[model samples]
Target: MAFPFFGDDKSTIARLLSTLPQTGRIEWIGQRPVRREPLVAVLEAELKTDSHMLGDHARPKAGGKRQVTLIQHESLTAVSSFLGLDAPLDPGRLRRNLAVSGLNLLALKNRQIRIGEEVILDITGECHPCSRMEEVLGPGGYNAMRGQGGLTAHIAQGGIIRVGDVVRVLESATA
Candidate 1:
């Protein structure tokens, strides 16, 4: 069933398709109202509704668009670099729920991501830093975090998410 010019080598096509980015790892996990405290070893991302997640105190309305927040280790590093810092910035200071690695989070907008095995989240949009960034990261902090502030998402399915668990892309965003 292959096209004339394109070879019938199905294996090659399969490999090429599989190479698309679809997986990441949870590097750190934190919750608000408990900033700078020890991170939870395991995160239970229980979603009772589309806009609800366990352990999140913000508790936006039932249809909240930002049920959870996630940040990338790379973005943290970029901010630190922007500020002339010697080391990467601590993710806790950003007040995000999950600090993940190996995923281009900005590219995930409108996509569905599965954390661990069952927890599914819908990428809502870029998470812009509030004025608190200056208080947390010192001078020029707010500007440093401008485009590096990670992303916001809503829980689409309930499940437990643990540090070191794999985060997989379930569905990609359509144009």
Candidate 2:
């Protein structure tokens, strides 16, 4: 017999917690193969351990916290409205490396998220919109992206990430 205040049995708790991982789908993949140029959309990308996503223009730094950036596909509508536009914003215009749907990216901050079966990402911080937003999104674009920008993450466990792959929230933030 177990005490009531001791909480669930270990195995039961493990099963429940594992079932709680949030699920989403990768809608698009983009890479800036050349510096200062546009992000080229692709069907797949390679993620390397402790490095930036392969084929991307951004150089990997030792112990870098930002190896990749992602945006929520649903935020385009909100960003469009913020800019007083009738149409949704394009993901490419945002310059994010990944576009995802069905999960709140912000809620994953400081958490460990997994893509597909092997690729794991540690959400480090927000992917703040840069001044380039003004150049690509027109006047007031910088402000329009405030709070609409997505999440930045580093490669926790590297592997291939493909379009249409599932994005799973494997664990909550430790701190």
Candidate 3:
């Protein structure tokens, strides 16, 4: 899909995107992801930090900037299976820098995803993919994670990220 989006010889992709600005740009922030994790609050209270509207209490300050991660809705669906039938993965649990609906997650790599009035995340690299996904998802939870999940990006500018905020992708050279 991205190949069709950036083909130099074909300007149609750009034109299509220009016409469909709102197709995949806006998504309602339903829930936080990590809040579903049992004992996550015990492990770290950063979830309650004022700087973090979701669960980013322990953002790195010495490294230069904090990291942001975004998980796909498909992955979110996968997460639901891991979560108990009684309790769903909280929207706040995933702690996605930007919870999106229409755009392709893979296509946004290395791009700047703008959230809120001042927050900008410099998608640095894939956040450390962990077995915690399996712990939460259970059973083939490990297999469900075979190449489908979330991503990690660094926060270029730090600010409060909350639910109901709009996200904009500031496309870069690679995007």
TM-score of each: 0.79, 0.85, 0.59
Poorly placed runs, candidate 1 (over 4 Å): 1-19, 34-48, 172-175
> Which 10-residue span in candidate 3 carries the lowest summed lDDT?
41-50
Question: Candidate 2 lDDT, tens digit per residue, 8-78?
Answer: 58876655544545699999999999988888999999989989888898977967888899999998898
lDDT of 2: 0.87
Best by TM-score: 2
Go through the candidates in order and give each one's C-alpha lDDT. Answer: 0.77, 0.87, 0.50
What's the distance in Å from true for residue 168, model 3?
0.9
Which of the two, 1 or 2, has more lDDT?
2
Where does model 3 exceed 4 Å of error? 1-57, 61-66, 78-98
lDDT per residue as tens, model 3, 1-175: 4665556654776565444244233343332344443322221112211133344333444333234456665555656665434444543445444445666666666567766666666655554446765665566555555555556666566665554456677755223
Candidate 1 structure quality by residue, lDDT tens digits, 1-175: 7664367688877554444476899988876545445334344455555765566567777656788889987888899999999999777777788888998888788778888878888888899988888888898999999988889887777777888889887745422
